[model samples]
Target: MVSKTIQTASPYLEGVYQPVLEEITARDLTVMGEIPRDLNGLFAHNGANPRFPPGAGHSWFDGDGMVHGIELNDGDAIFRSRFIKTQGLAEDLKAGEATYVGSLAMPGQGKRHKNVANTDLVYHSGKFLALWWEGGTPHELTLPDLETRGTFDYQNTLTGGLTSHSKLDPRTGELFFISWAPKPPFLNIGVASEDGRITRFSEVPLPGPRVQHDMALSDRYIGVFDFPLMMDFKRPDQKALGFVLDDETPARIALVDRKDESAAIKWFDIKPCFMWHISSAWDEGYEFVLVGARLDGATRHTKSGAILDDLPLVDGEHRFDSHPYMWRLNTRTGAVTERQLDDSFVEFPRVNDHHICSGARYSYMARIDINQPTLEAQGIYKYDLATGSRTDLKLPMHHIASEMSFAPRDGAKREDDGYLIGFVTDKQRMTSEFWITPADSIEDGPVARIKLPQRVPPKFHGRWVDAEAFRTA
Candidate 1:
């Protein structure tokens, strides 16, 4: 059965998203436009690549992990790609096939699960971590070579799992993430120290299991969005994922102080919505503002062996789509004031890491083609939060882009005075290139278009790692 959303035998295995087998380390790569000499760093991306032929019940979330790195220094480029070599990928290699079920798989297929370790990469505790989207063990991988070392657990203090969209405070070197379960201790929040030790960890009270894809962290507080997208693994619905969207309970947002453990985690009632990612958060003089892309209803994504085209399009399309929105919580009176920021459909909103959790002036996001079934970006957007101005770096027709990462210029004093780096592929020509667009003048398009040896499939998330990171302990 063809996927309605992707319109293929398996959406994960077609077009630009298809996985490649050969891992190569090619140096002195060809460049179309001149690379900036001052822009010296690694543009690293983490993605999924199945080692062997998966079963009919295969899901993209369960694909084996892979990492790709493109290093730039003094106008020279080096390209490297390697599989993450997770224990799950090892098990599949030993069996000569995929042998694990996942949260997106058919119910009762098997109890065995694999932490696919393919969604994101975070440089924390002086090491690169390949994170899985299912909130499980993170595998440590080296940069430039992209070699997987082993799973990390913060000295065994992080027991069950870890979040993929974990936020790192650059000023304090504290990593903030979350953990959720189906049973008691339904949710856990953790803050890790610079030495890779879990310093402050506590359980947030919740009645049932939830899929908190991302959280909001600021200088003063941590914000958790508790949507009504409840989980029921035993549900018999083949059309929907293994869960029930509980419409009875209104969604809630919880806020807790970062330093004060005695401060109770307070839950504020809000209208029901499903938000997969939060762009940025900041502490105003009197209010805490959390901004993100929000869909005004529950979202049921793809499941194993299920055909999405068979589902009702009207009920699924807009329900799964999202828009930029903001919510402000008054510290004095516990009041919530929210409003829509823009009308454009976008996702993966990001700001400069140096301005993270601080008052950032601009946000970079992918402008999606709402007509497409999958989340494919037609262009990139630079939305100004301070002046309500918008700048778009539009790609040509039939060209798609991946998530963009902001890199501050070597001597950049302002927040948006840098470049945006991401991968772009032309579907018609079957060619992929790394584009570097000026952040301040994004409408000018790319200054450098580095040609790649291999097609970079649309991965989940990536980061700009400075050359200084390699010298750290």
Candidate 2:
């Protein structure tokens, strides 16, 4: 019998983080409101769900990858979920226990374990790619049903692995991604065609091993981030992912020309901070605009060993240092100006899929409420970049929502003419619900809420695969 000691000790391993026992498929789910007839696609979320209780020092991010999805067709919803079937998960199942430690616990210690593939999911070339933030090969999954296909290496064309936060160009149907390793030529950038073919792959060397999470893109250039937070694999005492924030290393952005892969990459120096995700970026005249959530200091480690300390404390007494900010870089004068756009605590910023790599009028993000004790978000916030206005769709107390993904309507004309889709977890009831809200009217709440069969644990990122995306693939 499996031991229950670990599950009872860690807060993350209990409650919603507790793993579900079986795969399920349920049809005709209960819906709170009318589902839009035009909203036809699959809302899929990727998260970690450990089958066995994790070992000591395991973080919430250390669990195995499980994908939970809901398919919408002609106003009806069908819910399904499955494990990612990675090599590591296979071994764990065979042993009837967890054999490998997680990134936060073991870091470089467990080199033989399988890549977990648990961070984010993207649909490109009519297939879904499961990704991890710390250098993992992409795992492919079929659309609609989300059946696991296998690992994708672009026909073995990729030298290094892929990053979790790859940028997809909606205008050209090109996928722009970056990867890093612990050696020289440690960083690489590549672009894949719409049909999942490697078109342009190049090595962009960085100073050392740095944690490059997300990249920003415009019509002409792609932005690669090199922040101070990095890993030192050679450190003898290093633990928990080997990440250390070096104040001496300044933050920089490398702008690579998309049209000319061999063009000299321009480097721009910015303030020293850490940004995990980028909402959007675009070029106007000679200035480039980049917007994302920024943290002035490392909040991962607090004086106390509380897991919620990593989150922005919002008790009205302790102000949050992490918030959304906009950075304007002038290419002509080498001048960079940054200003905070919102005071409220927010993260996982996403723009309309149709407006990526270009100017977007609206941005959607998960908002952390002051009343919540955990790090999970309590609501969704929609921000208008043009007027500097914000509207929130607050949830009931203790209810948590995932990162929002904007799905554009068919033959949609305006940028905001789409629906925002995400998963909401009711901790009190130990249930989950898939929600859909019109992008332009987020303040009005979800238009439809389909109850899910199982409680999906807190996850990192997800995507909406339209029916047409499969037809074209």
Task: Name the best candidate (by TM-score).
Answer: 1
- Model 2 Cα RMSD, Å? 3.9
Model 1 residue 452 CA deviation in Å: 0.7
Off by over 4 Å in 1: 1-8, 232-240, 300-319, 471-473
RMSD of 1: 4.0
TM-score of each: 0.92, 0.91
Error of 2 at 466 (Å): 0.9
> Mind giving the per-residue lDDT tens digits that candidate 1 earns over 75-115?
78888888988887888778766666544544555544578
Instruction: Estimate every model's Cα lDDT from 0 to 1.
Output: 0.77, 0.78
- RMSD vs true structure, all candidates: 4.0, 3.9
**By summed lDDT, which 10 consecutive residues of candidate 2 come out lowest?**
311-320
lDDT tens per residue, model 2, 335-438: 89999898888888899877888898788888866445545777888999999999988787768887889988777789989899988988889899988999
lDDT for residue 200 in candidate 2, whole number 0-100: 82
